[model samples]
Target: MTTDLGMPTVASDPHGHLRGTEPFPVAAHRALADTQLRQNLGHATRTIRAKRAAVVGEVDDWEELRRAGECVKADVMARLPELLEQLEASVTARGGVVHWARDAEEANRIVVGLVRETGSDEVVKVKSMATQETGLNEALGAAGIAALETDLAELIVQLSDDKPSHFLVPAIHRNRSEIRDIFLREMPDVDPDLTDEPRRLAMAARAHLRRKFLSARVGISGVNFAVADTGTISVVESEGNGRMCLTLPDTLITVMGVEKVVPTWSDLEVFLQLLPRSSTGERMNPYTSSWSGVTPGDGPQTFHLVLLDNGRSNVLASPDGRQALHCIRCSACLNVCPVYERTGGHAYGSIYPGPIGAVLSPQLTGIDGPDDVNASLPYASSLCGACFDACPVRIDIPHLLVQQRAAAVEAHGRPTAQDLAMRAAAAAMASPGRFSLTERVVKLGRLLSRSGRIRSVPGPGAAAWFGARDMPEPPAETFREWWGRRERS
Candidate 1:
């Protein structure tokens, strides 16, 4: 009388906290110190940005498409619960088993149980963000199951024991030579003379994975778009690895975030158009796989769909932050994000990185205090608005950043030095006498000026500000004094 996976029935928090161990600034400081990382990120992002721009320029209706994507996502969020139920019914009707997981642990448990039931110790994986978000590979390993990543980039990351740095290209932080080194070091049976050429690297990875694919009995994936109308789940990928995983395995399991659903097949057209150019800068994905359950004598004989909430419902509750759920995983925001271009993904300390991660992570985890790492995520950006411009659904990431910042400040419970300084400034400016006195007192700082610029400041919060920047010297006379002198004249 054992429940799934030989474990007693138990429930865990659906929104189990997922955050980086270190605060963003601390991590970013270490990341910034790596010159090779900066070079790799700069080169890769600039190339992707150019390609995305050229193809996006080809479409006359790109803005309209963005609008449509936004509208459909909004509709999905508004009717999420109903749509999810409909989706579950549709998949079930089509001979698929649907499981609802409130949080990461539940999803992992469900998936592990399914794999164990199949009696397979090994499973092939298509690159899936949902699985990564839940730490599925680690969970599977802990259960004595091996999850083999078939995607070339993912394989590199797996072999290196490294976290993914970019959304589409998980190993974008590594150059060819570095990838070659990892393969030489970690990949078993790799050719002794393997070169860093892209083709050779891909071939080495392909040969390594082909044997696994042929023998793997179970496959796992993440859904890009789930069509509730037809109970169809779709995965859009550039590599054919996804196809191998989806069709070759006897048991196919797909895990998807609740926000990934679209109302109908027609809704996919807009996303199909938006995702490619914004992501890989292609007119269309090289491989698009869709299935609605088990097909007799074709594809997997068994199908399971895990619908994962994991804080998405909580995200939908916030008016300002809910739009984060509209993300299509295209990584357009990441490609255009200046902050991400420098520090790379690992610094953010979450699978979701860059502009979207900055706002989304804090909301997903809930900012509990000033010391929370998720709270540090909001300040990770420069607020230049490039991410919003590149977003397929126009998420207005800067606005979300501000909202999260305010939320963090309110949650801290104790005033920071900057807060105390602001309060002091507010009191000084509240009355004419105090303001005039403060302005005259500040003019005394001209003693610290060199060539009409204050290169350094000695104070608590002001030191970090002046460390890399110089402030313009105050005017010879305060504005109030100038006004008074003019009146006297």
Candidate 2:
């Protein structure tokens, strides 16, 4: 089916966190000029790619696992409404409250209100993409509440007052030395002797966050997966900070995209296996935490689950585009993506970035028109198909990109110059007489190139191409004529 997913089920923010302000080409141009960013991205992506390749090679049934994950996610999408309802019932039965949010604003409002109910102005947060998507921390801040990020990378991004560049490694664009600089400058408790050494940096961050973790009475997080059969919410991470956030606080708030629910723990198993290898190149995460509702005198006695739709329903409506929801936040596609490796995630302008972001962002917000910033994302790729191969859930990013490109063109509502040119070419090729006339006229282009190269085209549409490079001279004879002569011979 065409990827034109009408409009969002809800009227989402036009320039939501899911969208970037500038177009991809414009952002990418600036990123290309930043030598440090390119270096950081290149080094980090290559290292992760190597690790992922090594570990993935150990799984003989890796492809099978990928297919299984894909099937489970597809089935979940097929029965999403049912599963979400089931999950809500289970959570409520176990004493946890579930809140439904139709958009980012609603989700943020729910979270902010929940924290306010707890009578806490400060909260320690787990690294949550959903919260990031909703600008939850900013929302909390605006409400005079402080949201402190516990994840090491997220902390670095937060301390620096910078946006996350990558989802998994938010500060992947920052090198170690730069990190040391940020920690020294921003971290109130950081040691003056803190070196760029990984251990030292980790210890310094730990020292700084330890007090916050111990004192914070309210915690906020995002779920990696929520099981419908049981009211279990899982959060997997390499660090113990998420565990602290989950357990130390009296009240816990989790905001998750509605698409994150799985029908069964068995379905969760396939993803659990696929996610680790695809993301961190590990057999399993160091910390894979799952909590069901709340337990008396135990971790987070007051639990709240915010189920966020936020344009996800619109993505679900499109058969071609819904596959993006299958992403497990592994960041596998980012590591292997040639475009992402060079430009980094900032260029995509969405909290979600890389190949998946190109398709997902526009689908979430709906492409405004041909000139919409999100519309430029589909063209950010080289269609190399590496993203699909690396994806744990077998999302065909390249196909989705092509589909989104078509949907983008269709969104223009009127034929663009490129559209008109393509239409004329198609019409000409449909008739032998017209084709022959075009072939004769094509020779006229050769006259424009005395140097045997078309330095420029006579239109604005060709400026993007001819501005960068010269085109080869037109052929003296048509391929059809050559074929006829060969057949006669």
Candidate 3:
């Protein structure tokens, strides 16, 4: 089965069943009720925001680089189908197999079949949003394959059976003490005396993952970028686990979003500079591993690249929303977004969250109806434009938000009460006589006011607005009336 976006029915709920079931406001309300969650999110976002600001300030040509990245991505999106074909050809020539999946179910079936062919019941993984977006781990698990996450933060999320809250720092909502508790409770082999100290935690996780790395014969990962010109794939990480997964396994399978491809190796220059600084706030990532196809007796002897569309092709079809494909998953927007800082990623109800998610998810899901989980996502933003400034590829997120809002409203099939009210206001303002009469009508709001504020409005669609706030008393005289009086004086 396929959605209107051509996403496999299986991939429709990429966030797992329960998480993506609710609208953004419902999820956000629950999240807001958790005071500890708010504190953790606030502190983590503030810290990352500061680090990003400091490092980004050090770059002399950051804006130029952002433009360059944007231009390269625009070119990539324009020729994505061609580049993907070129990439497939290049990979095939280099002894790697490429599989194209239209949606999550197909991707999972392909991967599960591949793993089954290898006769491996277990696989180690580096953090890959593509796989996360497809719910690969759960699929593999249902197929009786254990997918072990090797990235520390991902490992933490996996061990605790929790969803990732931030793109860069998946467990950003968890503090050191909280991590220690998770480790103690979940890791069977963890030291009974394990301390919450950073070094101790690192050592503990290392000890746990080391055995899996050595024993695992199959590894699954996500690509940071695919070079269509060279058939080369890259994975950048602060930790060396990605390198281990790329090299140690006998069979390596990389699931990459179709949008992750760049036309050439030269295009990497702009992104490499933009990503690390924007993501980890470092001058350079600690580890960047790149490989092309298979090499005998060196890395994985069997290599497979699964290019996943899910709803990427659907997103590409949009002229206004397509800019979302330029996202590098830097999480800079997430760190800077006031809404995300307060509510956290879980509230967005997708593997993706924050400002980029707000714009991207709605388009990806095709906004099935007013009740769609994704329908609420476009309204998840404050439209502050901070996300645009923080974006490495310069996606105008606020513009896209408005675009998705229109899409959602149109998908509703009729004018909402709010829409009718706005239309009425527009009509009233279109003529001077109507506008003056409307102004006089508004003046009657004084009768409903108490202590100079209208605390409650008694009408359909008015409660949602008035429940959260008090409207100020209308001015006694219209601007035009005041202007006329001044002229007379």
Expressed as tens digits, the lDDT of each residue in 1-489 for candidate 1 is 101211223467544336788989888888989999999999999999999999999999999999999999999888888888888899999999999887789999999999999999999999999999988999999999999999988999999999988789999999999999999999999999999999999999999999999999999999999999889999989879999999999999999988999999999888999999999999999999999987899999999999887877678887667899999989999998888988999999988999998888888768888888888899998899999999999999999999999999999789987788899999999998999899888898799999999988888588876754698888888877889899999
lDDT of each: 0.90, 0.90, 0.89
Better of 2 and 3 by lDDT: 2
- Model 1: worst 10 consecutive residues (lDDT sum): 1-10
Order the numbered candidates by TM-score, best leading: 1, 3, 2
Between 1 and 2, whose TM-score is larger? Answer: 1
**Model 1, stretches more than 4 Å misplaced?**
1-17, 444-456, 464-470, 475-477, 480-489
Which candidate model has the greater lDDT, 1 or 3?
1
- lDDT of residue 372 for candidate 1: 85
Residue-by-residue lDDT tens digits, candidate 3, 15-84:
2321278988888888888899999999988888889889999989899999999999999988888888
> Candidate 2: where are CA atoms >4 Å away?
1-15, 424-459, 467-470, 473-489
lDDT of 2: 0.90
lDDT of 1: 0.90
What clash count goes with each model?
2, 0, 0
Q: What local lDDT score does residue 83 receive in model 1, on the 0 to 100 scale? A: 86
The true-versus-predicted C-alpha distance at residue 460 of model 2, in Å, is 3.4
